[model samples]
Target chain A: MENTIITIASGKGGTGKTTVASCLAMSARQTVQFLDCDVEEPNAHIFLKPRLTREEAVSLDIPHVDHNKCSFCGRCAEICMFNALAVLADEVLTFPELCHSCGGCWTLCPEKAITTNRREIGLIKSGSAENIHFTQGELQVGTATSPPIIKAMKKTIQKNSLVIIDAPPGTSCPVVETMEGSDFVLLVTEPTAMGLNDLAIALQVVRVLDIPCGVIINRGTDVYSKVETFCRENNLPVLMKIAVDRAIAEAYAMGIPAVEAKPELREDFRKVLNHIKGVTAGERTCCH
Target chain B: MKELVVISGKGGTGKTSIVASFASLLTNKVMVDCDVDAANLHLLLSPKIEERHQFYSLPKAMINREKCNGCGLCEDTCRFEAIKESTVNPLGCEGCAVCSRICPENAIEMVDTVAGEWFKSNTTYGPLVHARLGAAQENSGKLVTMVRSQAAKTAKKLGYDYIITDGPPGIGCPVIASIGGASLSLIITEPSLSGIHDLERTIDLLEFFGVPAMVCVNRWDICPENTEHIKEICRKRKIPFAGKIAYDNMVMLAASRGKSVVEMNSRIIDEIIKVWEKVFEVLCPNMKL
Candidate 1:
């Protein structure tokens, strides 16, 4: 079987993106690579508990100056689009938080005094839990950008396994960066108006990116059928529905995956994985 | 004007639900949705845009093919790898201006792209200033700052007493830009483990900014024990505990109907009211009940 990348994302946070990702990866029969790209607030690690085998510090190159070799020409500061550097009257100051690490400042410095240094913005941890290869990134607090760290994490993807990505919530740069290269996207959502609204926005993103996508309605109940109706109307398949179960909620609060909390649900999650495979395979045939 | 922001460390924890209820309950206020990426406040508020403006602050690299010397210097220097020969992928460009500076032929330029649009709208509540960031675009922090400043300006212009903002989730740049310097922030969280984990980080973030923060555990009934844990943590940290709200299907029904809990008849509405009262008391001490 060819390798497939499935990303679980939600327009709204806390709508079970990480939960679904963890359970799905755990229940899949094939070797799985689970990448938690929500660097800002990664939660899958709490559930996966993969043994850490490697930890890599991700850093961005920021400009440093040699005061003695420098004429305090403000040209470097003027060319910096992110406002990361400013040449003050008496000193040159750099705000590492604002730096995008574009390398424009030191490269353009006429005095040849500016050099670049790698400043840690985040770190990626990789290890394995049985059949599942686990990896996640943690962005340092106060770091503005997450795509670079997300990109770094994606570099460790092994092509031989079924890769499941737990994307950051919201349909923005970080989510887009995570979903870009995926073979399929599973948008997790609740049935609330906010969920439906955000789901539509997320659907637009995937559609624009031309990736085949489906919906997984978490916390399912008959009381809120708006999400289901919207998915049906849009012709997007609803692959799975995890009913709102109190036991599952308790297990989640205790940081346990539903498959473990309710052992019967392992069968349910396996069925969901099979359904995803069938759908993704069908789409590939259609494209060819 | 006193600005109060509603945020959650994790998403879907009822941040918007609380903000929507606050809008229905408060008078003389301006609403701002700082969650520009997946903006849903407009769906509930039904804001009719009175004015709209294009937001063009995020810069993208533009290579002038005519002036290109076919030299790969720009590509070699671009740390973001946005430049490939003469083509620049706008999504990959971080707007570093390194390519423009290193281009020997001066073919590269940093140009502002229309990243998003902001609107001044009239809702039943009051003036609402919100924006929609372009899908797959960077710089949500900039759009958030724009909406917040507009909210402040609208509040000052209309002589409103408050600016209530719905902040995005996580302690990222957008969240930082939203809660900084606010009169107070209401951190809405769930009773899940991730909620507590993220809540701690968000509290630390607010502390770093020295912004006074209050906590409200939404859907507290989902896990009563965890809810208790959350309250205990709040007490230990000396953070004021606003209240806990029980999970009610009616909140979902109200959201489906484009209404706040307070706008409907539900028991959760009473709990939200108490939460609001505590929030206002802490945030607006000078105002009378």
Candidate 2:
């Protein structure tokens, strides 16, 4: 079997993206590599319960000024697009939190007074839980950036194993970083006004990334047919519909995957996996 | 004027719903939606746009291929991997302008790209401020700051007593931008493990920024034990536990009809009213409800 990556995402938070991603990993027959790319508030670790085997700190290069060699030229501050640096009459001030570490200031400094230093922003933890190999990024509290941490975490992707990514909510830079190189994207959303609104925005993002995608209507009910109509009109595939079941909610509150609470749901998850496999297989032959 | 921001570290915990309810109940206030990437408050409030402004956050590097020799210096200088074969991928670029600065042939120029749009609208409740970020755009924190400052100016000019903001989810840049210098923040959470985990982190963030905070569990009945745990944590932290709302289907029903839960004739409305009173008392100590 070819290596495949499936990312579960939603524009709105708390739409069960983590639930679906973890359950799919638990039900997969292969050894799945589960990457929780929601660095800001990762919740998959609570359900996966992976015994972490390794920990690594993720850092970014921030500019540090060597004032002794510096003339108050203010060139470094002028080249910084993020406004991370400011030139004063006597000193240069740097705000590391605002810096994107683009290396523009250090590279452009004529006086050679600027150098880069590492600032730790987050951590990457990797472990295993049964057939699932889990890895998640933990962003430091009060840190303004998350895409760099997410990019660091994605470097651990295994080549031979099936990969499942639980993406952060919102269609922004961090969410785009998570879904960039995936083979299939499963968007989880509920059937509500806000849900439909956010789902449309998230679908637009997937379209911009040009990734093949499908929708999973969580907490599904017939009362809200707008999501169904939207998907139909957009020619998007509705892969699965998970009803609003109290038992599943209870299980979720207890840190149990929906498949574990109701064993029959494992087969449903397996079928979703199979369907993705079928779709990707055809795409590989026709496009790749 | 006081600003009360409604946020959830984890998404889908009824932050926007609760804010909409506050809008329906409170007078003399401006409502701001800081979730620029996925603004949902407008769905419930039905804002009629009175003013629209283009939001330009950071400039993107545009190559003037006509002036270029095909040197790869720009590609090598870019840390974002946005340039390939002398073509720039706007989605990959962070708009830092490093590539344009390092181009030996002077082929690259930084151009201001409109990242999103902010709107000033009139809703049934009052004035509302919201924004929509372009697909795959960065600098949401900047856009959030723009909407909030606009709301503050509106509130001050109109003599509004409060600014009720619906904040974005997660404890990231956008969330940080929403709660800074606010009078108080109400964190709407659920009684799930994920919710508790995120709540603790969010409380820590608020504390780090010295922002007074309160917690309210939206579906507290889903897990009574966890709700109690959350209450105990709040007590230990000396943060106010506003109140708990029961699991009610009317919340969803009202949302389906683009109405706030407070507009519906459900017992949940009373509970939400109690939560509002608690938050209001904190925001305005000398006022009578």
Candidate 3:
């Protein structure tokens, strides 16, 4: 059987996506593969505390204008929508930070003067902890883009093992890129107005991507009814609800995974995993 | 005009809640919501759209399948792997025009997609400018720039002295776009480990841009020790540490009712008022709080 790729995402940040991803991966039945796609501010590495055995710099190709072979035709600058390249009479100036690394200039240069050079934007670290294989990406502090690093991290996905991805927050490009190829998406959200509001947007995103998804309510309370109402009306399964536990909060503050500190909660995560497997299996059967 | 942007490195850390509260306390300001990805400020402000504009930032590649040659050359040449058997994955395509330029049959063309829309709306607080990016659309940074530029223009036209912006979370392109050239930024953070880690990254990003910032810890009671640690870091960096707001369930009720914490009678609101006073002192050194 192929390993299922489950991505834990939330439209709102700090809603326990990392907490859920780490705990679920730790509590899984088999050897779990964990990929932290929240490159912008990845926190799974903090909780997992994997002894990183390997590291690689994530680089992108930026156009380097060769003055010797250059006609300075200005075609590269004309095609660049990001204004990353500017054509001068003698030289073509490049802004690597603004470059999307789409390889447009290198391929479209009629003079063939456009060569490419690699610029390191981020780093990927991989290792293992207990029965889990951990891989995470960290975007350089000053870098403005995160999707490319996320893509690089996703490339390390192992299809033969059950993979749990902690996606970046929000419903934008980075989140979209993280959730792209996953078998199922688990949305972790709180029961606040902002949580419910952002969850709706996140739900819409998953629907557009055509991925089956379930919900996990973190810090569950009776204060807000909208999240529950929205889930029921949408027919989305409420997989698990972890109540507001002060001990859990303290453990999280100390960079501890709740399932590790309180072993009993592993049962809760196991149940959630079982539910996800059941739902994913049902979808497969229906499709076949 | 001075601009104060509220940003959190981690999401759902009460950035919107704090900004909504600030909007209530502050007057003669233009409110701008730059979190175009999952915009929630509109839900709180209840703005009435006075003018709306479509935001078309990124160009998407389209394949003219009729130009007829299944060469698969474009797929091989594409770095993003956006093209698959004549179909283009709009999300993956960065619209670099490499496929259109290299296509032997001239079957591909780049067209501007309606990435999102921005609006100038009337709210009780002031004129509000906000935007919503289409789901899975790229160019969030571009849309954020558009929203800020429009907000600046509207602020000038209306003779407003300040621009209060609700910035997006994460230290990425959109977050950069929100804080660029802003007079001041108020970072709303929590006291968790992830919160502290992300806060450091966000502060580093802000310092890299040479933007002066103030810090406020929301739900500080959740982890008082971490909250104190955050204050120590701020003090070491010479960044002003605004007062902390204790956790309160009233914030949840206020959000559900589309109201700011300041509107509700809560001790958290009082702490936010003090934070606003501190921010106002930094934003307008000559003005009285």
Please name the candidate that would achieve the greatest DockQ relative to the true structure. Answer: 2
Candidate 3 C-alpha lDDT tens digits along A108-134: 888899999999999999999989999
- Which segments of model 2 are wrong by more than 4 Å? A283-288
Model 2, position A101, has a per-residue lDDT of 94
lDDT by residue (tens digit), candidate 3, B1-289: 9999999898888988888889988778999999999888888888999898898856778989889498998998888889999889998888777888888999998898998889999988888999988888888999999999999998899898999999998899999999999999999998988999999999999999999999999989989999999999999999999889998878877877777788789887778889899999999999996
Residue B244 C-alpha lDDT in model 1: 89
Tens digits of per-residue lDDT, candidate 2, B225-246, equal: 9999999999999999899999
- TM-score: model 1 vs. ground truth: 0.95
How far is A104's C-alpha from truth in model 3 (Å)? 1.5
**What is the lDDT, from 0 to 100, of the residue B127 in candidate 2?**
100
Candidate 1: residue B160 lDDT (0-100) = 91
Considering DockQ, where higher is better, how would the candidates rank from best to worst?
Answer: 2, 3, 1
Candidate 3 wrong stretches, greater than 4 Å: A283-288
Docking class of 3: medium
In candidate 1, what are the lDDT values of residues A37-134, reduced to their tens digit?
Answer: 99888889889889989999999888888888878889888988888888977689998888888777787789988998889988899999988899
- Give model 1's TM-score for chain A to 2 decimal places: 0.93
- Identify the runs in model 1 with alpha carbons over 4 angstroms from their true place: A223-226, A262-264, A278-288
i-RMS for every candidate = 1.5, 0.7, 1.5
Q: Which ten contiguous residues of candidate 2 chain A have the minimum total lDDT?
A: A279-288
